[model samples]
Target: MTLKHGPIKNLDMEGMTMIFAVAKPEILKTLKVGDKVTFEADRVKGRLTVVTIAKSK
Candidate 1:
């Protein structure tokens, strides 16, 4: 997935849009363009990855 995220001070990352790999590919089916979600991300296998994600309640 690709995301435009807020600044992540821990990573010294500025808010910017970037592509990420997901930990679980099945999760993609539950989402559509413009869906609001809360997620956890990290570097997995040296690539930025979304570890978990859920629709905003």
Candidate 2:
């Protein structure tokens, strides 16, 4: 999935749209297109990955 996100604090990345690998497949089940979310990401095994994610409320 391509995500357009604000600056990611932990990853030290500027806000930009990009594809991120989800660490858990179930994380995708809870989300759909256009849902706003707050998440944490990391470089896992040489891939940029979503470590934890949740719907923004």
Candidate 3:
């Protein structure tokens, strides 16, 4: 999945847009392009992957 998010303070990353693989692709099924979401991401097997995701309140 591709995400444009704020800096991940824990990862010491600057805010930027990027595409990442989703560990649970099914989670994306209910989302739309402009929806706000909170997700957990990580590098797995050298690929960025979204471990968990949810619609933001």
Q: Against the true structure, whose lDDT is highest?
A: 2
lDDT of 3: 0.86
- Tell me model 2's lDDT, rounded to 2 decimals: 0.90
- Residue by residue across 1-57, what tens digits does model 1's lDDT show? 888788766557888899989998998888898988888788888888888888888
Top-down lDDT ranking: 2, 3, 1
Instruction: In angstroms, give how far residue 33 of model 2 lies from its true place.
Output: 0.6
Task: State the lDDT at 8 in candidate 3.
Answer: 78
> Which tens-of-lDDT digit does each residue in 1-57 have in candidate 3?
789999877567788999889887788898898899999888888887888888999
lDDT of 2 by residue, 1-57 (tens): 678999998888999999999899888788989999988899999999998888999
* Alpha-carbon local distance difference test for all models: 0.84, 0.90, 0.86
Candidate maximizing TM-score:
2
- Give per-model TM-scores: 0.82, 0.90, 0.85
Clashing pairs in 3: none
Better of 1 and 3 by lDDT: 3
Clashes of each: 0, 0, 0
